[model samples]
Every structure is written in structure tokens, then in C-alpha cells.
Target: MHTVDHLETLCARAWPALAEVPLGNWWMRAAEGFTGRANSTLTCGDPGMPIPDALKLVQRFARDHGIKPTAHVVNGSPAESGVEAAGWRVDLDHPGGAESLVMTGPLEKFADGVVESRDLPGWWELTAGSEITTAQRHVLGSGPNVCFASIVVDGVVVAAVRGAVVEDVLHVARLAVRPSHRRQGLARRLMGELAGWGLTQGATTCVLQVAEHNEAAIRLYEELGCTEHHRYRYWIPAVS
Candidate 1:
């Protein structure tokens, strides 16, 4: 397939899975939401077009759906070009850093362990320190396509991850382990479990979006045999 075609195909397969939420903006929108809705590039054509045109199209689509446009571009390496041409500020984010060598597999073995359901109120109560608002959690969990899990130890929830299945791909979203449980390989185990669930539900492969600066996540994903697929540009036009 052509470049844009390939990107759209991937987006169509991954976006809904990434967010696993509806597009209604009863709550405010974040830049991350736009990427999750991206799948139109296939229809738009590749090299795509001028940056402004691409931005306009995406922005229009987002707006129509009550979503605010917060554009982002993701490329594999610093050497890659055309990212800027897509109207996004370029930045390199490494998701997984040096925390490699962790083992990954299904969550079945740990299923009997203290895995708990983390709904909006519960998750918000735990992560109120960060920017996670109640609406964000609701949008994430309200959908049938999405589910969130937290591993509890000693009656305290320590590690967590969210999974969304869209099309035939399962996208892993917002995975984190509490500071106390960082080095115990819980994240990997959780990922393995999430991947297993996705596979069982007809997901052919799993994908996720991580920032370039997050070395820890990048390292962990690399260790999991995840490869760089496509780069996306996130554009938030400066308001005139």
C-alpha cells in the first residue's frame, strides 16, 4: 500500500483501540485524543499534502466530533524527516529506558492474584496527584471497548494498565507502576496479560504510543519485541 494508505490502515486499526472511547466532548479534550481518532490519512493521500491542509483536515474532523484538536507527530528517530512538514513541533521521546531484561507473558498465572477493577472514581482517587481528571477516566472506562486493571498488593493498588481493542488491534494505554513497585517486573507481567487478552479477542498485534523522553517505557517495549512502525505529527496551531 502507499504511505498514506498504510498509515490510515494502521490508524483505523489502532486509534479506537488506543482510546477505546467515544468522541463526544461532554468533557474537555486532550491532544492525545486526536491521535486516537486518526485513520483518515488513508483516504487523504500521502506525502500527504501541505502541513496546513493536513492540520485543517484533522482539526475539522476533531471539531465535528466535539473534540479539541491537539495534534502530535511521532517518528522513529531524530534522523527522520517530513514530520515538520506535517505541521507539528518535532520532539524525541523514548518511552522505555534502561529497565530492560524483564520477562513478559500472559496474565493468566497472575489472574488469581489480587487484580482489581479500577473504575473512574477509584483511579481518580489514587492518581489525583497527576492531571488525570474524572472526565478522562470516565471517557476511558465508560466504553465497552476499553477496560482498566490494577494489581493490588497488601490491599494497596500498586501497578496498573488500560487496554482498548479497536478493529483487530489491541492498543495498550496508560500503564504505570507505583513508585514502591517499580523494579519488580510488574509492568511486563501486566503487559503480557493485556496482550494475551487482546489476542484472545481477535487482536492480531498490539501497538502503543509512548513519548520519546520516556526511556524506561521504550526500553521495556523494545525488550518486548515491539518495533517502531509509523511516525505521526501532532499539530496544535498557534491561535492567531
Candidate 2:
């Protein structure tokens, strides 16, 4: 088992941002306008300056990249108070939800179906649901030693997932199933396929992030024997 900081570090590597800079120990990341995790400052460690000054740098980095300033902080981190005192508020309107839970367990426990190769016809459409952007392609398709998993039916991809093994941890994301195939366990199977592949790649631990409000996903992860390791939230400047 790894510390919260280590786990967070692994996740950052798994879902890398196109641009990243280190401030003290904090990571300022950006990927055009991909996702919050890709475009937020990971407030994991001390920034080696006053929190408010560090936050100013965070804002500058985000604005420079043409993204709204945001910070990702683990719950209970000492940095939280300083951020709030600086007038940053929790981004309750965040598309992914205000906060997310990091869940983890052994990949072998969830191993099931055979993993498939990358870019199976409808996989991108299913995952993105609309036009895919350069940032999405760069961040999702090109991660550290990444592999994609999919389930096909009648020559069409009905389910898909993205998996990457970073230092023995399998980071799973973007699991999507065709609407017509919902509740048929396709999501679980696709995850299994990814797990099988990750294990082969020397991954023993499986980690994924789910929105705190996503009860259904939480139930699914719990059923897979995944335990909540920690929760994180995004913060943005409070509106005046």
C-alpha cells in the first residue's frame, strides 16, 4: 500500500497532462481543456511558499494555458485552509462533480475477460460521445505504457475502457457502455479485461476515481472489492 501522496503521484502519471510544471512540490498541469484532473494544480505537497502566493502561481499557469484556474486537493490536507482563506471556493459546478473518491484493490480480484487492442472502430465515439479534441486524444490516448480494452458485439464496440500501468498500478478510466447494453455487466467485463492486461504488464494494484455523488459507480466498485483510499475536490477562485 502507498501513502496518499504516492497514490496521487501515480495517478498523475497514469493520466498525464500535456503540460506540467513543478512549484516547490505541487504540480501545475494542463491539457488544453480536457478534464479537471488534467487541467488543475495538484495541491499534494507544500509549494515552498505562502499558500496564497503559490495559488497565485496556479492561477497564472491556468490562465496562460487558456483554462480556468483550479486546484486539486486531497481532503484533510493542510493546504485546504490556506486556499479557502485566500478566497478560493470549491467548484461545485464542476462537470465531473465537486469531489471524487479514489478506489483501489488488487487487479487479480477483478480479472475476467480477455483484453483487446486499441482503437476498435467505435471506441473513441463511445468514450467521447461527440467530437474528439486534440487535448482528449493527447491525454487519453497517449499515457504511460497505456492500453485500451473493449468488448464487441456484432462487430461493434459495445463497451470500452482505458488502462495504463504506472509502476505496478493499473489506472482505469473512461469506462463506457452502449445505452442499449446497460445493466448487462459489460462495464464490469471491460474492467476485467483491463485488469487482465494490467496484471500481465506487472500491475498488482487497480485504482480508479469516481465522483462522490455517483452512488451506482461506487456500488459497482465496492462490489469489485475496491476500498476507498481517499477523496479529492477542485477549488476555484470564489466569485466576488
Candidate 3:
């Protein structure tokens, strides 16, 4: 469990938010309205200060950054109960915001070459949906350790994924497959390539975040030998 916590911390660093303010052992992150993981306060371990004081600081940090005061609490952690007791409500209304699982596995099982690294522009063209927002661009291209993986077929990119390696763990995100290319084992192949890339970069493990409601994706990852490491949910102050 402790090692899982440390791996998660490294994963957070890999896909960094736009702004991160340290509050004891917690990280108050802000990146507009991009994603909960990027905007919420990540309470990994003890804050080293009073919980109330830390909450106040988190509130102030969110307000200063013009984002809603939100906290990402590990499901079974002390912080979850504390924040809920303090009037913070789990953000169930947000799209797929209720519960997310952090899945982990070794990088040696999947076969390589199904995916290849590409530049930001090429990666975005293949992965981004019909429209791209400023916040999306920043979140996808923010970190230096990121690798943009894509699958090109018949001279056109169809499947893509992103991997960021930090502290021997590869954090995978932004996986997409074109509608015409779905159900062809593209996602699995892409993950295999990502695992291969991670191994070459000295990464021993791979992790990816998926909403609990995403049954298909969850099944796919499970079939690939990834198991849930932990769960987390976003908690926001109840509206007065």
C-alpha cells in the first residue's frame, strides 16, 4: 500500500497540472476546468498540519486560482472521512467523477510495436476529438517526460495513447481509437507498445486511471493483467 502511494505520487508528477501549490504533504493543483485530477487537492499522506487549517489553505488556493474548491481523496484514506465531515460532498454530478480506479501492472506482458512515439502536433491530430480546447492542449502537452504514442494504418493515424514515465512507473493517459478502428485490438496493441516503451525507459510498472463506470475499458485493462491499486473521488464543498 505504501509503495502504491509513492507510485501514485510519481504518476501525479508525470502528468502535472498547470499549477501546483504544496500544502504540507498535500498538493493543491489548479488547471481551470480541465479535469478533476488536475484541479483538485491531492491528499496523499498527512498534511503535517491541522486538517482544518489545511482545508482552509486548500480553499484559499482554489479561490486564488479561480477554480472550485475541490479535494481528491483516496476512498479509504482518513482524509476522505475528514473532508466529508467538514461538509465536502462527493462530486457525483460531474461526468464520470464519482469514482476512479488507479490500475497497475508490470510492463513485460504486452507485445511491442503496435504504437510509436510522435510529435505533439501529429499526436494531437490523431487523438484530439473534433474540437480541441486550450486547457486540453495544456494538459496533454504540459510535462517533459511525456511520450505521444500513435498507430498509423494505411498512411493515417487511427489509434493513439500517451505515456509519462516517472520513478519507474509509466502513467498512461489520453488513449483514443477512431470509431472505424474500434474493436480491432487497437487499444490493447497500443498499451503493449506503451509498456515496451516504458521498459526501455527503465520503468518497471504501468498505471492508468479509469472511471469505475467505464466497464468496457475496465474489462480491457483487466484482461491485460492490470489490477486496481487504489480508488479516489473528488469532493467539493456543498453549495450553501
Candidate 4:
């Protein structure tokens, strides 16, 4: 029963990656590096560019930046326009299913092994360090006004999940597990911990946004009983 207004606030607070994930700015933080915000439209992987240009832009962006760039096309734009106009084959827009639905619960009910504050910062650091794109890094690392949790194994930090309570809804931000520690159910454990925190923060429910193409992630969410809700159309103007 998460409302659109609530989700938007959650995205703004918890998942700054949606639109605020910093880009081209972090490189400035790095000595001798150049930074630029990810083009939201008309730059590359945008639906308004020519097909060949779109592909090339995508390839170049990924190659140079080490991250996949997505095109947010304006809905209702005729297939003959926008990305379609750009000469790219249209795959029926969202050939994928739908955005995942949100679920709410008491934090106490979800708490298991207990989430500790000592390990939270390190978990954030590791997760942020692993991001390939500046936007991803910003959300996971420097995004403003957020809360988080981390899981430790044998006294060693292994997994982490962060949530931001924005507009009374909890948006799960960065969730990460060490590559060497996969398949141990740590992520689920961390997610449970995050849910607990969300409830305490007055969040009515929790929401997460993931790429439609990420099958593995979608399956994991489904297994966790997360439902599919509405899909959001991501559109970047050819110039904006």
C-alpha cells in the first residue's frame, strides 16, 4: 500500500542514486581525475538518439566509465519518436515485467542476530568502493540523510544494507556483500536487519528500485516475498 508520493520521497531520501547519485563530481575529489554527471538524456543510451549513436554511446560510456547507462524515455512518445526516432529498435518498452511492490513490517519481527552500529561505517565504505559509476558511488557513499545496517560473520564484517526514511517510506539504498562471501544468505540477513530499522524510523513500508534486466536480483527479491508493483518510465531528454 505504498503511495507514489511516499515512494518518491523514499527515493529522494534513501536512494539518491535514482537522480542524485553524484557523477563527474567525485572525479574532482580524486586527484588528477575528471568527473561529469551521467547524462540523463540525449547524450548516450538515450531514447532520442539515432540507433547507431545510442549503441556507440552505450558502449563508450560503459567502456570509459565501467558502468551501464540507461535511457529514460518519455512515455506516450510515439515509437516513431524518442528512442524509436533515434533509430533504435524498440522492445515494446519495458519488455520486462513491472516494478517490484513494497511490503511493510515491524522491525522487531524482522530482527534476528541483531544489527550492530560498529560495523556499519566499514560496510558503507566497502559497498561504496565497489561502485563502478560515480552515481552509484555517490548514493552508496555520500548521499545525504540516510540510515544503514551491516552484518558480521565470525566477528568479521561480511554484508551490509542501507535504508533511508524519506517521506515516511523506507527506500533501501546500497546493499552489498563481499564477492568472496556470496551464497551465505548474508544479504537476506542484512535485509531483515534493514527492515527492522525501517519500522523503527516510522516507515510504513519499504521499497527498492532495481533494473528490469537484473534477473538474478529480481529473483532474489521474489524469493524474499517482495511483490511486483508499478513500473516507472525513466526518461532523459536528449539534452537534459
**Which candidate number has the best TM-score?**
2
Q: TM-scores for all candidates?
A: 0.60, 0.97, 0.92, 0.57
Worst 10 residues of 4 by lDDT: 25-34
lDDT of each: 0.49, 0.89, 0.82, 0.49
Candidate no. 3 TM-score: 0.92
* Candidate 4: regions farther than 4 A off: 16-114, 118-121, 130-138, 141-145, 236-240
What ranking of all candidate models by lDDT puts the best one first?
2, 3, 4, 1
Ranked by TM-score from best down, the candidates are 2, 3, 1, 4
In model 3, the runs with Cα more than 4 Å from the true position are: 120-122, 130-134
lDDT of 4 by residue, 89-121 (tens): 433333333222333433444444434434354
Cα RMSD, model 3: 1.9
Clashing pairs in 2: none
Clash count for candidate 2 is: 0
Best by lDDT: 2
Candidate 2 lDDT at 19 equals: 97
Q: Taking the tens digit of each residue's C-alpha lDDT, what string does model 3 give over 94-140?
A: 67558899998887866475345686455687666657777677777
Better of 2 and 4 by lDDT: 2
The alpha-carbon lDDT assigned to residue 50 of candidate 2 equals 97
Q: Provide the clash count, candidate 3.
A: 0
RMSD (Å) of each candidate, 1 decimal: 7.5, 1.2, 1.9, 8.2
Report lDDT (Cα) of residue 68, candidate 1: 51
In model 3, how large is the Cα lDDT of residue 46? Answer: 85
